[model samples]
Target: MSSSRIGLRFFQNSRAAFRNATGPFRRPGAQGFRFQSSDAASAEQQSTFQRLWNSPIGVKTVHFWAPVMKWALVIAGISDLGRPAEKLSLTQNGALTATGIIWTRWCMIITPKNYLLAAVNFFLGCVGVVQVTRIFNYRRSLKDSPVETVKELETEVVDQAKAVASEAEAAVKKSN
Candidate 1:
């Protein structure tokens, strides 16, 4: 037999194996319905997630939250950059934690047999906590560090005072 024929035979056998494992859809009463493509306008109403996800506010929120969540994922190290959707900021992390808690509760309620998902939810919440603390610690250390200037401490202090005075003067004029 030719190489191409052999390859085709292999493909046919694999297809047969797949079909045998699970019966084709729309076969009969026990079988599932056949898949069909449908336009959005003519089809069933969109899912809650799909509706919100395509909206302007949803787009903006995902874009903004992605960066913050990315940073947190970086700190976690074990997490994948592409996983969990976005880099949520500290505030967004709170939302994420709440989501995890809700999912855990849902899994517990829906199926006690599937405790694995609940465990995953618990881990998700922990990651959010760690991410928030890491962000805070990093920011606090960055703020306290004296790496910005070559000038002495006193010169830096004097310069800041002048800047504050000028800002105050501007504010006073603005109020007039």
Candidate 2:
């Protein structure tokens, strides 16, 4: 009739109920639920997507999403095709190239072997190489033709100065 005795009785009943619900196969100290035949059959009836959702490299994991997000870099590189080669940074492209090559190989070496990651890295490496080549060729051409390079530099400076002046004028007009 004591509070402690009532708690003990409740605990005993709960344990007995759980044991009955779980069936006779489970050990007293067992950690997890043991699936019965019905449970096993239901698991076997799981859809492909449900199976994939629980898989090691499935959508629930970072393994499936990292490469998906990294695709933006590839798209950005492709978009950079329209930009002048002289504007591209040699260091940036070189870093991308190195990262792509290194990760591409590492993807294959890692457990679960993400082929999608490998493909993305390969394309990223190709884009980086192309950009690097363009920058190198542009610099080489500038070095080859000193007079043209000087003219080009002067044109760029003048254009930038004009753009700044126009922006300042617009700001003044807006203030007025």
- Best model per TM-score: 2
lDDT, candidate 2, 30-124, per-residue tens: 43333222345655888988767766777888888999999999999999988999788766787799989999999999988999899999999
Local distance difference test, candidate 2? 0.81
What lDDT tens digits, residue by residue, belong to model 1 across residues 36-154? 22344622577766655644334345433443454443355335323433343555555556766776687668622335556666667677666655545544455555443223434
Q: Model 2: residues >4 Å from true position, as ranges?
A: 1-44, 145-176
**Per-prediction TM-score:** 0.31, 0.59
* Ten contiguous residues minimizing lDDT sum, candidate 2: 29-38
Native RMSD of candidate 1 (Å): 21.1
Going through the candidates in order, what is the number of backbone clashes in each? 6, 0
